[model samples]
Target: MTEPLIERCGLRYLHVVGRNFLVWRKLMYASMLGNMADPMIYLVGLGFGLGGFMPAIEGMRYINFLAGGMLCYSAMNSATFEALYSAFSRLKIQRTWEGIMHAPMTAADVVLGEWIWAALKATLSGAAMLIAMYLLGLVHGLRPLAVMPVVLLIGLAFSGLGLIMTALAKSYEFFIFYFTLVITPMMFLSGVFYPRSALPPVVQAIGAVLPLTHGADLARGLTLGTPMAHPLLDVLVLAGYATCGVSVSVLLIRRRLLK
Candidate 1:
């Protein structure tokens, strides 16, 4: 009985691990090299290059201020790439989940495992960026180090959201709608390049609703030695986003598959 229960619990998640490893295996050194390059370019080009004209922000050098925001941005990008692009393709084209479900695995188990896997990858990417930030001396002392785990939580929050979007997506084209209307606006308005306080009251209120805004706020506060507007509130909001998104994805995938 113990062995059976253990297998039942472990089989689905193990498959998810194996599948993700397989996917990672197909990514060549060139692809990894490109991902490594994109962030550095953003850091140098926008941070160092454009930062000169951008003015000093919040008592820190503009480039340094932007690095925290860029870290948040990078984490979001890594999560969405796996959850939206790859997850949707696997579900629609590869039918990978279908094959897994035919065995002892349930949809819930597979999705939970897959989302965790995506979050793991996102966290790894974020950690890599954090190391780069440390090397630059942008992160001082143990506070930023303490915040590293929270930064990963932020990544998981976005990964969960991206998974839900993948479930809702009717086609890959639908992703553009989200990217354009929601993400693009948030990317610009979120205190990435500038403080949200500079926005009009109404726009500030709107920015408050976006996940990236809170993530960036928390990150910038920690990294730049700025006081948090409301640290607990930001954590709660991020947690809420993760919970709702994961719940929705689980429900949708269950309806589509196990039902």
Candidate 2:
């Protein structure tokens, strides 16, 4: 009974993913263009423009230092955008989730499927950025390839976080508050553009708790071939956020849909 039930759930979610992929295929060009453009601009603009005047950071060129962070940021941005805007549109505007619920699937399955879809999209975006970095010679050696799993982990963490916001959102406008208050701060404070050590002690402490910080640390360590201060702790932190966020998202969306 239990095994069959699990298989059924997996198949249902895979169906959802397949449906989304088909829809995305129609707009693949635009989606890929936008995803590639944004990160490339950031990499060139901040990395070269700003990094030109900056001294070597952590014993590496500024662009080299920024590359790994960009990889993590790409994953984070992709996951969050898919979870917030795309998920909200499906759940509220397009009524896609409503249509899916009419099938044999539960609200839990819908949310899980959406989360998985978002994570996959994030991974693709991150992979694109990683390839660009590699072509530019910012990443070297086989160790950089190890960052792929970390990118997926970052995706999972942010996707779940995005869905939580989606559940609380009453309208599209609600996301402005989340983006401004939460995501923006995390981008700046989470060691993406600079080292966490440069921040004040209190802010550093706060950054330490953010999922992106751990993700950045992991990505940087792998890409630069530097040893992590505490790699095990970083993995644990990201995994904790992903697990909690998904659980909370399921519970929240269940209440919202059932009510």
Candidate 3:
């Protein structure tokens, strides 16, 4: 009975994924372009433009330093966009969630499936950035490939949080507040553009609590072959965020859908 139940659940989740995959395939080129463009621009524009005027950081060229951060950031941004904008569209605008719930699947299955799909999409963005960095000579050693799992963790972490926001969102405009107040600040404070150590003590303390900070640290450490001060702690923090975010998102989305 348990095995059959588990298989049923798996099939339900895969059904959701298959639907999303079909939609994604139809717009594959645009999706690829959207995912690859921003990170490449940041890497080339800021890495070269600002790097030319700055000295090497932490014993590597500025572009190299930026590359690792961009990997983590790309995953985060992709997950967040999918969870917030795309998920919200399906849930509210397109009425996709309503249609799905009319099937055997529950709201929990829908939310969980969406979370998994967003994470997978985000991983693609991160992988593209990583490969671009490699081709441009910003990445070194086979160790950098290890950053892929960490990128997925980053995606899961952010996607969960984005789902929470989506649950609370009534209109598309609601996301603007989340982006302005949360995402934008996190982008700057989470050591994407620079080291957290360089920030003031108070800001560093805040950064220490942010999921993106842990992700950026892990990605940078893995990609650059630097020793992480507390690798275990970083993983635990991201895991904690992913776990809690998924739980809360399920509850909130369930409540909203039932209403």
Winning model by lDDT:
2
The TM-score obtained by model 1 is 0.89
Candidate 2 on 15-105: residue-level lDDT in tens? Answer: 7788889999999999988887898899989999999999999999998888888888989999999999999999999999999988878
Model 2 alpha-carbon miss at residue 227, Å: 1.7
**Whole-model lDDT for model 2 versus the true structure?**
0.90
Order the numbered candidates by lDDT, best leading.
2, 3, 1
Residue-pair clashes per prediction, in order, are 0, 0, 0
- The TM-score obtained by model 3 is 0.95
Clashes of 3: 0
Scored against the true structure, residue 159 in model 1 reaches a CA lDDT of 79
Question: Please, what are the lDDT tens digits per residue for candidate 3 over residues 122-238?
Answer: 899999998998889877779899989988888899999999999999999999999999999998999888887889999999989999999988998998887788989999999
Clashing pairs in 3: none
| lDDT (Cα, 0-100) at 233 in candidate 3 | 97
lDDT of 1 by residue, 55-105 (tens): 778888988888888878777777777888888887888898888878777
Model 2 TM-score, all chains together: 0.95
In lDDT terms, how accurate is model 1? 0.78
